[model samples]
Target: MRAYETRRGARLSAALMLALAVGACGGSTEKAEGEKPHAAAADYERGPHRGRMLRDGDFALEITLYEEGPAPLFRLYAYQNDKPLDPKGVQVNIALTRLGPKVDRFTFAPEADYLTSPAIVHEPHSFDVAVSAARAGRTHKWTYASYEGRTTITAEAARAGGVTTERAGSAMLGETLPLNGRIEITPEGKSDVVARYPGRVVSMGVELGERVRRGQVLARVESSESLQTYSVTAPISGVIVEKNVTVGGITGGQPMLVIADPTQLHAEFFLYPRDAERVRVGQPVEVTSLAGDHRLASRIEAILPTADLTNQTLVAHVPLSGPTETWRPGLGVKGTVSVGANAAPLAVRTKAIQPFRDFEVVYAKVGNTYEVRMLEIGRRTPEWTEVLGGLEPGTEYVVDGAFLIRADIEKSGASHDH
Candidate 1:
């Protein structure tokens, strides 16, 4: 009975393998045949005019795009047996199907030497084309694909590749002023420890850079007049930045120690004469460290009325809030002050912008396909860019991993051709 069961199981396994093989072969064959029609244009023959050449026996047609004039327009030339054919004798029509399955139809009119399309051929010269010609009561038709700045990836693949998208729409565009500054402790956050009277330091308990609490004993001072010793306590909880007095050192009016609270920090940005009028207190400022490893969102707290006598630059104080463990006094920082703002009808994430051909574009996604949208940009900030034209509102665009899509499209050998 055991032997019989084993033989039956072997037969079942063999059947399953055969079924999978047949399914795989059928799917592959179907996919190849389906792609052939679209793949033909990439391998189409080119005529002398550098346009795609479509031929049937002794009759041939050459299509070219004439863009040296006002706008891009299609020009067609006809031939018979390697000799020129009269453009008036042949009637032609062309259809272009774009990525969104939108179709554009064009009709040709005969000119002096060739037939020219009256309608302009829009940019991205990337589409599947269908051509029809009628001559002597016979009709000839050919279909091929030409694509550029476009690519198609499966949804699963796009997700795995980190390709994310967001709809393009209204955004607040802010105009900013660039300012350079350094982190500094607020005046109220720093303290200078001094003795009540002229005295000599008896025993110093706290060292430089030591963390101390308010009312904590920091040192023992013996007064020269009273002839007695008194404990000197910290006025504020902070780190000791300067220790001027050592044991047995005489302390008079000078500060014996300086303590600064790191948490009470602010960035001091300098404004030149041109920028002084634009900046005001309460304006939002984005401060970043010189190394760019840290960033904090702050606002201008105050603007000094007087300018520095040396450089004549005014100072704007922007207070840093939240956890400031990484912010250190005297650390150089850069700031962008949002002076003014306007609402733009269409905007996209600045990082989504990519260079495509002669245009700065963002990849608009529809389903599994991605295509470029050339932009006429307006005022731009580091986070968002205003779109003046060339993209429709509410269109989904790639916010991240846009380079991956561009790379895939380039790797597919898409080109700009007539």
Candidate 2:
């Protein structure tokens, strides 16, 4: 429903709650003529089956509402002097007064165990109800209102409960392109320490995992043919990620050390062919842990023209611009690429969202009164949601602690209209 309609209905429901309380306590309209209003208070009781009981001496009428079908059903069972009263010739009329001055009338016909309404009742079950019944040459009429699942709290109380409100403002919501990626060592960041020729090992200069500088000797080998010792130097400044030579082992063409700089790593992501065209150099991307807890900022550096033969997905390489320790080769990550963005003139914090009845709603603070407004959401994210309708841009809403209000409304028995 629209905001105006729901707000109006909610306000009417509140009024109905007050009216029901007062009228239910005053008993039925069958009071003796000229009887004082306070002569005998209504002694209505809630029956074991959760039905409403209307009693007068030995005559009782139990009313139960069924909502498991397409419409609201009002079921009534009558008794005379504590015995089943045949309702074959009885007549009943029920009028439901709703907001906007709209009223609906329902007639009743005797069914197997009770009298059922002739037509299905419409919603916003919150309303002022008047029932008139005629049976055995006697007429009876009564009126009461219903306001279930509604609550009201002062602004001061809301504030004390840690609730805060803010008006939504315009923002740019990104069209995220999510991809799975892994940190990798770029060709520029890796180097192999070679023996340069066949030789017998003489000395070891560096150990596995040792940090080394360019041109630093990682091992010294004696050439078997020349019987001369030569040093194997690191081709790049990096940690010795691999080592194959020992102090006394002979080596030939084999790498003595494999050096790689973790800080100079790049991330590779695979995207579908369609997603590849939208990715451009320098497009910002957020890198998150596989668990989506930590984040690092990066940008696309290159887009490979080739597609993976197995997955038929294009590859994109990104350069990390944040702390290097947070990313390492062989680690998987989630990358959100900003492929598109839109301007949202009206929006709200996602934290304020809650499920109310059959709709998603946010509690809007209207002056001293808080109204529950249903929302039509457009673009949404973990932090913000764009408002398509149901709320104005300048309207202040409960951005935090909204669950407290939801609990209060349910406590009022106002949400069980169904």
TM-score of each: 0.81, 0.63
Write one digit per residue (lDDT tens) for candidate 1, span 1-418.
Answer: 0000000101112322311111000000001111232233345556888876777767888878888899789999898886888999999999987767779999999998899988988766766678888998877776665556765666665665667899999999889999998989999999999998789899999999999999999999999999899989899999999999899999999999999999999998989888999999999999988888888898999998544577667899998876766888888989999999889888999999999888999998877768888899987899899998878898899997787777655554445655
Would you list the clashing residue pairs of candidate 1?
none
Model 2 lDDT vs. the true structure? 0.68
lDDT per residue as tens, model 2, 233-342: 87889898987778888787677678998778788888887787788888988888887767878889888855447656777898764566777788997898888888
Tell me the whole-model lDDT of each prediction, alpha carbons only: 0.78, 0.68
Please report how far candidate 1 places residue 301 from its true position, in Å.
1.8
lDDT of 1 at 264: 95
Question: How does model 2 score by TM-score?
Answer: 0.63
On lDDT, the candidate that comes out on top is 1
